[model samples]
Target chain A: MGEFRMPSLGADMAAGTLVAWRKQPGDVVHRGDIIAEVETDKGVIEVEVFDEGVVETLLVAVNAKVPVGTPLASIASAGSIAAVPSAPSPVQAPPPAAARVHATPLARTVAKALGVDVTKVHGTGDGGVIVRADVDRAAAEVTSTPRPDRMRQAIAAAMTRSKREIPHFYLAHTVDLGPALTWLSARNEARSVTDRVLPGALFVRAVARAARAVPELNAHWTGESAPPLPYVHVGVAVALRGGGLVAPAIHDTDTLDVDGVMRAMADLVDRARGLKLTATEMGEATITVTSLGDRGVEVNVPVIVPPQVAIVGFGKVVDRPWVVAGVVVPRPVVTISLAADHRVTDGHRAGRFLASVVAFLEDPEKP
Target chain B: MKREDIEAVVIQKLAKAAPGTDPGSLDRDEAYRDALDLDSMDFLRFVDALHEALGVDVPEAHYPKILTIRACTAYLEAVLAKR
Candidate 1:
């Protein structure tokens, strides 16, 4: 039997509340299937199972808050001996509701005061016991709790840690988008609205391709000497309609074309705004791209989200005078900026990655 | 379609793409990104909605020309006239 522990969605996430479970005991589970929905600092994330097996038992009850590495469930892997006999079917009458409801003394009092059924509320206390906070939360459900406030606090904590530990180096390159714009126009002219590609998507693809090309910049600086990730999953930073922002990965972005990236980006942004991001999407980013240019800023210096060595940012694409082969001319230009961890890689390697992105954007047909 | 009709369609589409945008208060001649706080993805979705509504293909080259509410309606009118 293998224990499925609560996964750390990022370096900042310490604990998560088990909101719901998709699979129950005796249910067959695949490696990538979402077995539970976990409410973390980021948001409520669809927690995926990394083990393929039959779920033996769900250890943690719904709404239980557990720290990272707490075993959420146990899976009986295929080919393992089913040696242990199942417990004898309960022959006696079910226990009384008060006897069955394992709750703390404070929780019992709070539940009584609020006229709440303690048995109905899932407990986060020791050995699946109800707590006072759980009772308070159950009582507050009628009043409606705001979601983003907690998420904002979580982001603040994570970004704070990122700035504290990661010694970051910043680099900016102004890429002329004249050729890219011309190429994109020709490509988009023939495509339908659904099939048309956006420049943002193109940039994501370029960044992914560039990360693949420059392997040094595509890694996590965990202080431990770990090997680089085998593939690039570029996280696109999306601002939520409510308040906070989330940067979720479009998995294996290097393999996707601009059209594919565009669709993925649109879907991600929509889901992110809708507050439905999965844990795997939140955890799988090898790098992040934030295009603040949509608000018309020319450039932005970004903070590196910890562990991930680099972040790519883009400012607004605007008409500007540029030098092409020693001649000044008007062209659509975007400032591409990179914030990389100096501990993982130097400015030279980051520059190369940025150059690759610029080159790819300039000749997107070849990217 | 009349310019008003086109503008109405554009505004409806914009409102749909961005849930909280108030089309009534928007400046007709100001850039939609500035006026509506629309990102590229939001703008693209708005364009997609327009294409679905009008069945007119707004090419990438015309994005800048039709960035404002007034310009988008005028551009759509010209496209409809040509068609």
Candidate 2:
């Protein structure tokens, strides 16, 4: 039997409310299938399971808020159930039917820990089986604790942990956006509005390409420093209309062209605002990029999301004096800043990464 | 299409692109960002909807020229007349 645990969608999430299950018992499941919908601070994320198996049971009830890493279901691994017991199954002994209560093991454990009588706890699982949610609900009814905003609380805990653990180094560079804007304008001169690329997408692509050149900066700071990722997943920070922000990854962003990046970014941003992001999109980023250029902020130093070692931020682009070829001239410039985990990389390496980003933008024709 | 007809199409598309936006209250000469709270993505979708609805192709070079309600209608009127 294989256990399917609740996925950690982000570093900040300690628990998520299981909104619904997409699969039921006896269903054949494959890798990468969205098995459940989990509501987090980011939104209702479609949670994907990573193993191939037949679902044996759903361990958590819908609307239950459980901690991350709690097993949500049990599944029979593929090819593991083909051999049946020929005779009386001498190796295994069946429990007496009188003591058998249709309850998940995790639920029974919780009941024991909380000193709650298992027989009295209401069951809401398949065939009236007690699940973790029943214990949680029973506990809640007894304690009457006020429900806090789980998403907000999770984000706070994660950010606090990130700040406490990671030693972050900050660097900023003012890059001339004149060449990039001119190239983009020329490219879009004949295209329709929907087909035109946005500057935010351009920054994402540029940052990805830069990370490729300076591979050291594109990494996660897991206990031992793992090698830089072979491909880049650039997380674009999108502001939700209501209140919170989410930065979902655009997978393999460096390999895509500007137009491709723009399309992916638009789709991701739209879906993110609607709370329809998948688990892969939520947790797969190697690095993150945040842009507030539209808001007209000149410079910003964004915090690093945990596990990921680096974050890049862009501020408002405005025309300013530039010394090109030793002569000062008016040109559009934007401040690009990098917040990197000092444990994995130093300021010198980060400087190279930032410069590479600027270099790509300066020659927008390349990527 | 008449100028009124073009304006109606524009307003309808804007209203659909941005929910809760009062298209009827939009100032003809005010920027959509200030008047309708339409961001760049929403504005782009509005322009695309206009093309899809009325067959008016808005070239990127003319984006600034058609940023406001009055300007968009005027530009669309000229393009439709030519077509």
Candidate 3:
């Protein structure tokens, strides 16, 4: 592409505002054809197109303020359409996202949040893999959310490091589980509902269901090294029923079901209450789920917990007024937070994952 | 370093800095653009490498004066003399 900058039509012209662009973006123009009109310091001047081809980009618009030499329009070469030139390529790059099989959850979040497109962000770690620090550094370059609370502080440190060093982004869903919970309750009542399906277990089950649908969400960040293991570990944050919070996760939540999540949630909550959590439980988690609001959150951006590239928060389930078919009805609402590393996942992918989570929560009767 | 040695090092280092094309057979008389077919980035890379190699501070004000190969030789000689 060739840049057509605002020129000093006369010696009197030091700067000129763009009065209008006669040719819009992608409009074809031949050499010497006037592409735009500029109001010069002396008079209105017609800026001519230099090369022939389609107008690839117009940096300034009609009534737009501009300076001399400020690139106003760009034309493609002979028969060449000016595509947004990919930012000058950084030396070595990553392979495609589809080819990426196993990365740590934390690494994935870090990558997605950073908008680095994990598939393209070449991994320097062992086995051609991308790591936590890569995502951390990338996140730091973007949104630097500083220290606030203990979990928030730990999360900030982890994310700051993730953004600074790693890359990540997330998709999310504000789910409403009143209907699903009602269904579970109805089934329980019909069968003399003994175990009151803990809301956290339900939330975990919802996570498992959605993850199974999108295996990409169930992935782990494979560290900086290449040739690494390619599976996702599921992290579940448990608010100790008595005091404090215990978020020991159920590794590989994608492979498990509601029943498995129930057992794991029970075990973790028990251990967490007694302060019996281990280092592996704390450090090795690829994803973290905090059910501060029980089923989901009101609104949240869960911090990516270091090596784990994704952290999802489930807020409290509340009964509120809702609209359905133009009628006001008392219904339940749930919100979830999907704070991820922006480097790998775009907002669109993260939005889809969140939608999947919402879809699973809305009508969860499954095989 | 001799003037020829300095110029050779600058050209060689510039080629590796951007990772693609090299400083195409430059000489004291050749214009920088005509010699290497360089764009702005290539020139910037050359300046950065030159600064790194010689451990001297050069600023943007020197760009217009030292853009050509002959001009670069003159600028380096003057800087070396001053140091």
Candidate 4:
């Protein structure tokens, strides 16, 4: 029998509340099937099972807060039910006072606004008190409005840890995107509105390809050593509507074509805003790319997300005067900035990585 | 399509693009992107939804013409009338 534990969705995630179980006892399960919904600081993540088997028992009750690595379920290997022992007792008891309506003032107000019953909502806050986010989750079953207060706290924790632990160095390079925009427009003209690619996808693809060329930037810094990651799962930072943001990964970004990157990016943004991201997408980024698209910011010096040694930032694409063949001309340009862990790589290597990105963006069709 | 019908489609798509935003609260003449705090991707999805709903092809060059509900209705009505 194999035990399925509560996954650590990110370095900032310490515990998650079990929102619901998708699998039941005696159900046949396969690897990669979503088994549960876990509520974390990021939002409710669809947790997937890695072991293929028959679910023997659910060891955690819904609404119970489970720490990372705590077993939440048991799965028996296929056709080995007779050899396996009986289901183990639940790892945690459900929170007390299921009938009692204990909620924060903000939660009560939100519940009233959203037309959700305070008593019916599960409280995941301290001492099993319902919070505003809990009421939002109860109202919208599949998606919830992330409580700005909680999200801000989460961001504060992660960013503070990053600033404290990671010695960061910043680099900036300006790339002319005139050729890329011209090419993209021509390519998009032939496709349907839904199928058309965006310059954002080109940026992500360029960053992924650049990471492949500079493997040192695509790595996790684990204290004594920073080993390069084999795959490039580029996290795209998406700003949420209400407040806060999430950077979910597009797995194997380096291998995907521009079209694939666009599709993946669109889907990730949709899900990230909807609060329906999966655990792998939440946790498996080897590097991150943040863009302040059309926000009119010329440049941003980003902070590194912990463990990941590097982050690439893109500012608004704007028309600027450029000298070409000794002549000044208007061209669309964007500033690409890199924030990397100084301990892992120096400015020389980071400059080369930024150059590779510029080259890819300048000649997108070739990459 | 009638202007009301087109307006409904825009509102429906806008709701999907930015969930939790109340359609009833939207100012018809205000730029929806600013009103809804939608990013470029969300706006693109809104356009994609408009295409799927109305069979209208909104070129990238014409994005500014549909920035608000009032503007989108006018644009769609013109496109649909031509069709």
Candidate 5:
């Protein structure tokens, strides 16, 4: 039998609460099947099972909080004699509702005072247990805010650790978007409104291509050494409508064209805002790209998210005076900035990476 | 469709585009992009939602004319009237 453990969804994630289980004992599970939903500081992530087997036992109960590496379930290998038939005979029917409801003492007191059913109020606390605030929110019937405070705390913890541990070197290059815009306009004019690609897609594709050319930039910083990832999974930083942000990976980004990037981005953004991202999408970023699209910010100096060695930032594209062939002329321009870990790469390598990005953006037609 | 109906459709699409945001809180005259912190992709999605709901294809050139709730309603009104 193999154990399915609670996955570390990010460098910052320490523990996650088991919100719900998609599979019960005796259910056949595939290698990539989402077995459970885990709630972390980032949000509720759909956790996938890497082992294809029949679930023998669910070690963790729904709403139980477990640390990274804790075994959540056991699975019998596929075709094994222990693999029960499709009809699920749960080894353990989830503990009775009375016994399953985990809540803090304060929460119980508050729920009693407010005449709220403690069992009915979903817990946002550790291990899916109810806390005092949850009781109060239930009492007041406020459902609009979805734990933005916990998300903010998560961001704070990650960013704080990043700034403290990672010695970052920053570089910026201004790329003329005149060529790109003209190319995009011509390409978009022929397409329907829904099919048209945005400049942001071009930016992501350029970053992916540049990362492929300069592989070192697409790597993770283990304390001992920096290793380049085999594939470029470029994480796009998406701001949540509920007040935080998540940088989920667009898997194998280097293989996608601009239109593919656009479609991927649209789907990713929709799922991200819905808080339905998978565990791999949450954790496996080789590099990240962030943009302040059309908000008029000319540049941004980003901080590297730990484990990932580099992050690329793009500012708003605007009109600027350009010197073309020794003559000054108006041109659309955007500033691309890179924040890389100094421990892994130097300014020279960082500069070359930025140059590659510039080259790709300047000649967008090149596959 | 009536102008009010167009406005309701715009609000519904906006809510769909930026899921967690409150459509009722949006200022009719204020730019939806700025108010909702919507990036270019989100705005495109809002436009796409409008297209799906109303069968109105908003061209790229006319994006600026529909940045606000009031503006979007008026633009859709003009387009639907012509249709």
Candidate 6:
């Protein structure tokens, strides 16, 4: 018998949601066959089986959130759980009459530590046996302490690693927006109140264009100093309820149309504010931009997301004075600050990126 | 295509599609935002126009290439040339 456990994709991931099962029990599985879809912060990824085996028992159900090293299923040629290393998670323990209820190697170790009757705790693990969590939970209940859930631990590790390792360089530029404000006011007046164009939508478009102009800023930076990616997968930061943060990438904002971008932004914002994002959507961000303009943070130096080379911070749009062809004029200007990875991009490139972003914002209609 | 010609075409198209942008006197190869005021909305509009003008789809896989006016123009040109 062999144990099929969930492998940890990264240091940040503790548990993964089994989105779907590609393979079923009793069907023979070969190595490299896509067995399941696991949701991690990076998005939905196909999980492949490593060894060829006969599926003996299905240990976990689809859509279940199972921890790393958990036995997703078990494979065997005959009635045996003794051959596998261990089974480490709970499942719907099978009928007792079908198989011998023996504790797995790890389960026996955990059972010895907990002193719980492994047979009595109910072997929900593969082949009707106790696993690590059953023993730990049984032990915890008696001890009166619950472990921190998998989500919390994963989030902590990702954020901590991002903060410590990435060296960030900050660049800020104030947009001169006399013409842009003029254009916006006229455009709003021309359209019905119900159909007025979105300034927020316009800003998103601007960032997309700016990144395109300074293409180098669009990719994620490898911490070990590898070259950045050529394409830009833009991440939009949205504040969730209860005051936490999650930045979900819009896939390719640089390539989407205004309407498409508007819809995507709205959908992602709604999800980031709620619970709609899959682990895959949350995980793979090439670059991210934040909008705290609603919250009134004028200038923010956000930390560079690991693997991502830069993050743009958007702040409040307020009226300010500016020069137009040597004439002083008033305008509704906003501050755009870019936090870039110093290791991959220089100040010259960063400045150009910010400048391009400012230009895009000032005239989003420009093709 | 010469860099200048590509930049001019980008400026002309952007002005027609979204207006109120100044395609400054900087070198044509200068980045779009550095030489002109075409924010994200303008950028999106530009992409839409590029698709319409080039008769080429900016499929999900090709989106990352729409970075600069020259780059965008070159992509459009390549897609059109291939067609």
Which residue pairs overlap in candidate 1's backbone?
Answer: none
The TM-score measured for candidate 3 stands at: 0.42
Runs of candidate 5 exceeding 4 Å displacement? A81-140, A143-148, B20-27
- Give the clash count for each candidate: 0, 0, 96, 0, 1, 28
* CA RMSD of all predictions: 7.4, 8.8, 29.2, 5.1, 5.5, 18.5
Looking only at chain A, give the TM-score of model 3 against the true structure. Answer: 0.50
Q: What is the TM-score of chain A alone in each candidate?
A: 0.82, 0.78, 0.50, 0.87, 0.86, 0.63
Over B1-83, each residue of candidate 5 has an lDDT whose tens digit, in order, gives 99999999999888877665777687899888878777888788888889888999988889889989999999999999997
Error of 6 at A274 (Å): 3.1
> Which is the winner by TM-score between candidate 4 and candidate 5?
4
Off by over 4 Å in 6: A1-11, A17-156, A181-197, B1-83
Q: Model 5, A232-284: lDDT tens per residue?
A: 99999998764789999999999999989999998898778767789999999
DockQ, per model, reads 0.60, 0.41, 0.01, 0.72, 0.71, 0.02
Sort order, TM-score high to low? 4, 5, 1, 2, 6, 3
Global lDDT of model 2? 0.80
lDDT (tens digit, per residue) of candidate 1 on A18-131: 766788777788898989877776666778898877887778776568899998888888656364235432222333544577776556545543546677898998898889
Candidate lDDT (C-alpha), each = 0.81, 0.80, 0.57, 0.86, 0.86, 0.64
Q: Best TM-score goes to which candidate?
A: 4
Residue pair clashes in candidate 4: none
TM-score of chain B of each: 0.93, 0.92, 0.71, 0.95, 0.95, 0.62
Error of 5 at A216 (Å): 1.0
The TM-scores of all predictions, comma-separated, are: 0.81, 0.79, 0.42, 0.88, 0.87, 0.54
- In candidate 4, how many Å is residue A47 off? 0.8
Evaluated at residue A258, the lDDT of candidate 3 is: 64
Cα error of candidate 6 at position A161, Å? 1.9
> How are the candidates ranked when ordered by DockQ, highest leading?
4, 5, 1, 2, 6, 3
Better of 2 and 6 by lDDT: 2
